[model samples]
Target: MRKPRWWAELALIAVVYAAYSGGRILVKGGEASAVEHGLAILRFEEGLGIDAEHPLNRLFTSVPALGIPADFAYASLHYLVTPAILVWLFRRRPAHYRAARAWLMTATLLGLVGFTLFPTCPPRLLDAAHGFSDTMAHFSAYGWWGGEASAPRGLGGMTNQYAAMPSLHVGWALWCGVMLWRYGRTPLAKALGVAYPLVTALVVMGTANHYLLDAVAGVAVMGAGPLLAPYVLRLVDRLRETAEASPVVSAGCETSAGERIPGQRSVRTTADDKQEWGLPCSSEAESLGKAR
Candidate 1:
């Protein structure tokens, strides 16, 4: 397969990211509804005896070293590591990059759909009685993020705080991990591939930015990506082929007999050119002339 152009790929990524960001901001559900959804999720987890957010949040907030780094990871690595892996794939694994990119984009769109459908308040945003702490808020002085959900200081208002149903942070990290593990031949790369997603899931929970179920939903979204990516890629390819195959009509073009034909170029043609242009051969032309 021919490698995609770098500039075109960059533009595509930028457009998709912009759409994703805008979708998040636009789909901020009402705070009351979001809180209710979050509580419902918490209750469901409790019923299953798998609610781990409280313990993780408590552990992280109580320890400075853990909280500080986990805060940093929650705020920064979601933006940095995913793209780094994308670039790595584009540069080193061209053959796999297209499918991987499609999968990532598909999963990201699905995450956005989840955000739109069920905007859940994160554990950090829950009441004090919930026993969860916002690690980013606690470590605000140490990093650029304000008390808000990983947004930079004073810029938190720009982000959708309630769009936290399926955590794309964990989903994207999973994507990056899979890419590294699948494509990176180095042992270190393989190790990072396994560790990155697991650590990110922990960090997000420890920071209270995502519930365990949110992380599970994120994984579910990524799982669906591979199954859907082939159809998405195939649709794109079909559209591209259709565009390329469409005839381009040159205005004022005419045949030798003064008959204007749509989509015919205005140029003299040789036998090979006639064949390429879908025009009649010399013998056919002569026969047509005699009949006329």
Candidate 2:
């Protein structure tokens, strides 16, 4: 089996990420529909208290400090936690890398759609509400949090700050949990498989980085991809089977490669590459029945 060239692999990642980032810039810059969604969600908060009276929010916000002011702990964790978790996911189950990448890309698209449609403000931004101070003002925050890039009302920034309806932190953590449960089943792995997301849910609520409905949106986005990715993959797969194959690119990764021949040029042969898609693994059959 020929191997997938590193350059080709890098090229694929670059193209995908570039599209992902560009999509974010274009969508949030408009804040088209996100305003309506944001306002509606904000209304839900009217009956409940997000301040000192809400013990659930307080416990989530306070646990990280162990006594110190937890806002920074909450914020710091919010900022730093995702990349590390994603890194672990990729390293532990590289087999799911493609699916993981697709999930993230889809969520970004969904976020932009939300931003454009429902441009709403977060609790921290609600001036009429009592006991709300822009926590970001006191703590160091991301250079670009949302719509602060253009006029206060304009949508010309890295993101639609109002796009908080889908708690991506929840979405990604749930994605991580499902992937571990499906592909990396071990005792500790299974426990964390559950815990990481529960903690992430806590992180979002405690920090007020997201509202409850945002978490719901995140789950919704993740669920949508399974239905959507299959149809997309069918198109890619039709191109994969012409009996000419590469060493590095797996026939299973997408559907455009040819049959396996013993030359290693287009594939990577990583441990994970071998486990799931090592299609082109052998030239034994033209096309075979997939396992159940």
Candidate 3:
């Protein structure tokens, strides 16, 4: 197979991000539904807690600025860490690009879906109904993306303003962590692999940008991406098969067992061919004009 290149994938990423941004900007801001949804979630979580005075929830609700000092650490996540890791790994580890992109895109799609379906406000706005006050009010640096001009206006904020459940911030960290752990060799990378999600969990919690459940959902998305990607591809493969089976189709060659087909040609049986494309040989196939 011809190896995939990074530039094409980067271009694709741009397109995906633009689409995501555009779709998100369409939701109504300051919707009452958002507040109600957030309250319901809070109540559900309260019910599920260890007890009425669930220590974690109590502490979490009581301490608004829990992770405030770590705001800069959290901010650096999107602005620096994730993109850098993805870019560097993209060039150096071409083999992982497709899987990584598929996972990332799946997570993105789910996140957008969450925004549409369950538009809950973050703790910043969850005070009245939840009987909570600003735990993150003092943290000026934390709300960098909260303001209007700071966010990219994609054809006018079609986005859900209060979509805080399933924190993509936490989801991305988990994604990066897992990918790095699976594919990387370096110790520092591996260390970051374990630490990224943990740190992100803290960041979101401390700043009250997300509830514990949002982080849970984020982690769930990252974990599900890889597992789900194959099924997604199978669906694509099925569509291609269906399209090809139509009457007007001139079918491509189907190689017999143990045969390696060239990109340009096909055969039913194995044979020694002339050229090897310098790729690691995988099966019995051939091309023209080179050493044995």
Candidate 4:
């Protein structure tokens, strides 16, 4: 297979970002439904005995210094780390690039679908009675983001605050982890692959940007992507092979009585009477010539 071009990859990344941002804005108006879904998720977490988001947020926010870093992780690392790892994979491990890229895109698009369909609000956006503090707000002056989530202060109104289900921050962090762990040559690299995602999962929950269940869904989506990609790729390969093998029907090269004749192939014998069927193999053509 041909290697991917740098310009094409850059363009594809830009397009994907544009689509994600635009889709989030378009599907973000369902506030009441989002709140209900977020509440339902919290209740479901309690039922499953994994209600950690609230306490995590409370603990982290109790320490402003710790909360600042967690907020930074949510706002910046979620956006930066995935793309950086993707570029590294593309350049360093071309053989693994296609499958990894497919998995990432599939998981991310699935997250978009969840954002549109479920539209769960984040813990920070929940009622003040919930005791959830918006850590990003508390540390907004330290970073580029506004009092809300990671959007710029001026552009905060344009972002999708309610699109919180299936937390992509955690999902992307996990992707980075998988790539580093699987491909890294050193012990430190492997350790980072495991640590980064774990840190991101905690950071998202601690910053009130995602629920425990949302991070769970994110991991589930990432897991499903690789499982489904192989089948989809196999189907595509079959279709491509079928297309290449199918005969190409066209008008005959020679004319008869000023009209084209059908059933005649485009290939012809050479001037030396050597049979050629538009293929370049001399031994095969010699066999055809002898058969003729």
Evaluated with lDDT, which candidate comes out highest?
1
Model 4: which ten-residue window has the lowest total lDDT? 272-281
Please rank every candidate by TM-score, starting with the best: 1, 4, 3, 2
lDDT tens digits by residue: candidate 3, 185-256: 999878989998887786666555667788888888777888888777678678967775544301222243
Considering lDDT, which of the candidate structures 1 and 2 is the better prediction for this target? Answer: 1
Which rank order by lDDT, best down to worst? 1, 4, 3, 2
Query: Tens digits of per-residue lDDT for model 2 on 1-292?
Result: 2333446645765686577556545555333345445456656665554333134445543453421244444435433554555555556656666556566556656655665555555544444343333333333243222224212223444444565656666776787677666666688877877887777765555545566677777788878866676555565566564333434544333233353434534433444555544454443322332321
1 or 2, greater by TM-score: 1
For model 4, how does the per-residue alpha-carbon lDDT over 157-253 read when each residue is reduced to its tens digit?
8899988889888888999999999999999999999999999999999999999989999999888889888876677679977776554323233
lDDT value for candidate 4? 0.83
lDDT for 166 (candidate 4): 91
Q: Name the 10 consecutive residues with the lowest summed lDDT in model 1.
A: 248-257
lDDT of 1 by residue, 1-292 (tens): 5679999999999999999999999998999999999999999999999988888988999999999999888888888999888898899989889999999999999999999999999999999898888888888999998899888888998999998879888899999989888888999999999999999999999999999999999999999999999999999999987775565433332334556575555454455554454443345444554575
Tell me which of candidates 2 and 4 scores higher on TM-score. 4
Q: What is the lDDT of candidate 3?
A: 0.63
Candidate 1 Cα errors over 4 Å, as ranges: 250-292
TM-score of each: 0.90, 0.60, 0.68, 0.82
